[model samples]
Target: MEIERKLLKRSSLERLVDMMRSDGNMIYAPQKKETQVVFDTIETFADMTEDYIVSNQSPKFVAFPKIEKILDFSISQEGIRQEGTQLAAFPPVVVLGCRPCDADGFDSLTAIFNWDYKDELYNERLKRTTLISISCAQKDDYCFCTSVKGHPGSTRGSDILLTRFDGGDYLAEIVTEKGKALTEKYAALFEADPGIEKDKFLAEVKPRFEVEGLVQKCMGMFEHPVWIEQSLRCIGCGACAYVCPTCACFDIQDEAAVSKGERIRCWDSCGFGLFTIHTSGHNPREVQSQRWRQRVLHKFSYMPERLGVIGCVGCGRCSRACPVDMNLSEHLINIAEV
Candidate 1:
């Protein structure tokens, strides 16, 4: 499936936006405001900005949503009426400029949504959208995808992949059938070029982990002291779950306004003190240490032991969103020993 093709230069990102528009697809990217890049729909060429580390929030919400209105219930003189609502229409969507770590999180998350309960809403939206994953040569201290099982120039859940070239050009690689078709449609925008530097390009992108023993090593430690030491500063505010790319716990409640009441499911977090509280005024994981233990166990041990795949994407959103600066990678590295 390897093919040599001319890539889009840094200057031609505007042209890519035009390609998205002409094909009747809705494009969502890291749009530039005044100083920062936020996820939104672009109007002109000025909105496309992929230079930021990661957004304040993960792009998962753009597809799954934080809190969604599934249906409406009304009680009138005629007794009661229930009005149902399905997930939105399957609009052709392009989640442009998502990184390799950004895209891999979705593949790890897709399992939970499709396991015992088939969430058609999440799956349908995913089916329609195209993820353009990337590999960043520029990384900081906290960007540690290599530790577990991730790489900078990796193709995880990307339909299309892009790598930064030496002279402002991108090495565009198609990872899926959808990406191949999309590229074929925009064939005029690309040139068929023979790549002479394939080995050099592959050498530039190397995975950092000896992934064979990671899961087994992570599975053997349950009562390890690192959980207490690592999570000592945590306050259990649930902010990590709020900003996570793969944390999928939710709570459903009935909202009664006037005459109409709707049953809604909103995102919930295991990190919150109230998350494990019983109706009899008893709480299990009232302490932050216990909550943090659950976080690691769920990602490394419980999830892998049960679901066959780990629960984290190494996106560092949890670490980024922590008020006390509780870094996940720093903590996980300590646990990697056991």
Candidate 2:
């Protein structure tokens, strides 16, 4: 479909949020949480914070939650019974004010969940969700979305992309059917297109390194000493994977008392020491350096070869969240130069 551009005044945005909530859609927006800006459930437009470059965490949890129940089982005297999660029960969600990089992370998650096995639960939640992203007008040193084929104004995964003009109004680009439906529903809120250039209002994020070249360099660096040198201070806390938008490793466990239990899927990380532990008490990645190498190689090499998608979205949340001050973009640049 041809993209439709429109102008949305500041007041219209507040009204749109009200309309969406009245229409039974759960609205997720970035709000100030003490010192951090994070995505949380909002009751009104006033609940959102306008001064953040990016949320401390991505909105990935809306679909692929940090912890989720997949199945329930019960053992009776007669036989064992099992019940699966109802995918259809997932609620309609609108992620408002996410950055373009945060929106783009969904593609990586989709590729992983759909490869070799289809996760209907995840697909169902994603289908019911709509993304309303705002273009970034400012960035910090940690941001590197441009290095990974993304832009501040890119509309790759957003249903609606809104770029804020100098006057505080938004240049709303309806990029998908879901976005068009939203505007159509609230036609009164959206005005005619004002013909403003979106790029002029977006942040200038310089590309740190060519992704293709970085990928090629990573393929030959498996035995390189860079991994050990860079991972010397890593404490194996898995903070990077937790804050990352595209890391999809998970572990499944069952919680029960005696006869009844529920199977849960929780987030996991390649940075952890026990992530690749074997049943024979052997670990393929015995040291922190090997585990750190797995983290980089999986994102830059393995996922691209197998799933045709890069597992990292260059959101920079991992770098900011790292307690040891391990900057991922700097590490990638050094790797490329090496």
Candidate 3:
């Protein structure tokens, strides 16, 4: 619980990256891919994108991949053999330049995975990864972290947090024991903080809505026309859930050869028509409008009631990725007003 502050020079970041890699850690940083910025496995600091507000994808994939192997199986002459998931095999990771919203979203993911049954794979990766989140200096209109009780410089799930200073240096907040270990191990890279504050350069995001009773309001709106109006243009591509920081729906499948096979879990979306189809061929959420209502209610109502945490972190990637421009903030604000 000891909060340590330090100063990091811009030039020293490359050295830090080198230090982490030399320590047998995998580095995940934001990289430029055409017009989008993505968090990718990086070997050097030069591979990352600078001055980007948010990544096209969340760092959630670092721990919970879009597709992951759950079990490997083989059939023999006598019987069947299966190899289960191994916790010791997960590698140590250092996530650099993670935004505050994405870091906070990790808490929601952790809550879900560890809720009823402990997911050893995800927990192992979570334990092994150290987040070095950078405060947002720039944001677009789509960004609304404040609406979800998050801030640009908040340290919810990050181990270490970095904020840009006036002189191109970074003000580092060692938020956790892991972060403290990292700074102490690489003590040469960070200098004692000279009382410089982080607020000067932090991006200011206004709250989009009064979220107090919105979840309750959503229940009343199950039959409301807003769902139809809002989701009419939805193409059901599931792009929003894919880019979301806290969407955790997934489908398990067994991919098999003649004698060998693997059980894998892949990302799924409630936005899709097939998400809740019964085995008897009855779909509760048969239409796009009902499916849209499920997304809103689950995030705002069910998650909060069940997990004691709001699901959305308000990174705004869903709005950015949606082809129909289904702005979540606008829709939520409308719901709040209703």
Candidate 4:
């Protein structure tokens, strides 16, 4: 379907937030948390911070939580009973003010969750969630969204994409049916199209390296020495994976008591030393170099071959969050040159 264009004022945006809240939708927006900006549930539009280039954390947590209880089980003399988390009870959610790269990361996650088996929990949460992304008017050195086929104002995964003009008004592009419905519901808040050019208002993110070339180089460099050289300073803190939007590695654990137990799924990272440890005390990726290889290959080589989508959106949160200054874009550029 063709996208519908409209104009939305800053005042109208505030009212729209209120209207969504009144309709029982949970709104997650960027808020100033101490020294960094993060996405947190907001009661009103005023809670959102407009001064940040990007949120410290991606809004993926709204659908894929860091820690989630999948099921609970009780033991008895006769038998054992288990109950799974109810997906139908999930609340409708709106993730507002996300960057286009952040929104595009969801595609990688969706491919992983539904690769061979369907994940009802993830699917349900995603179905109920609507993405309202705000275009980036400025960027920092760490941003490389364009290198991964993403733009500062790309509407790949957004329901509604809002680009702010110089005058504080927004050029709203209703990209999906979900966005159309939202606009229709709050028709009064939106005005006719002002025919604004969104490109001029968006941040200019130049491509660092060709993603296809990077993928090809990664596919044949499993045993290359570059992994060891690039990861020499890594401390295996897993900060990169945790802050990344597309790294979906996880660990499942069973918490048990005398009569009951719960199964939980928590975020894990390939960078962690214990991620590949076996009960026999053997680890496939015992060294940081091997782990680093896994991370790069998973994103650039393996995922694209299997899932038909790259496992990175070049959001650069990983680079910014790395304690040892491991810049992913620079590393990939080097590999592409190799």
Runs off by more than 4 Å, candidate 1? 1-6, 10-12, 32-36, 88-90, 194-214
Q: Cα RMSD (Å) between model 1 and the true structure?
A: 2.8
Model 3, position 11: C-alpha lDDT score: 83
lDDT of 1 by residue, 218-246 (tens): 66666677777888888888888887777
RMSD of each: 2.8, 1.1, 1.2, 1.1
Q: Residue 35 of candidate 4: its Cα lDDT?
A: 98
Q: Please provide, for model 3 over 207-292, each residue's C-alpha lDDT reduced to its tens digit, 9 standing for 90 to 100.
A: 87867678677657778888898899999999999999899999999999999999999999999999999999999999999999
Q: What's the TM for model 1?
A: 0.88
For residues 141-181, write the lDDT of model 2, one tens digit per residue: 99999999899999988999999997999999999999999
- Candidate 4, 143-214: lDDT as tens digits: 998999999989998999999997798999999999999999999999999887889998899998999888
Clashes of each: 0, 0, 0, 0
lDDT value for candidate 2?
0.93
Query: Clashes in candidate 1: how many?
Result: 0
Which is the winner by lDDT between candidate 1 and candidate 4? 4
Q: Please provide TM-scores, in order, for all candidate models, with all chains considered together.
A: 0.88, 0.98, 0.97, 0.98
Best by lDDT: 2
Worst 10 residues of 3 by lDDT: 210-219
How accurate locally is residue 279 in candidate 2, as Cα lDDT from 0 to 100? 92
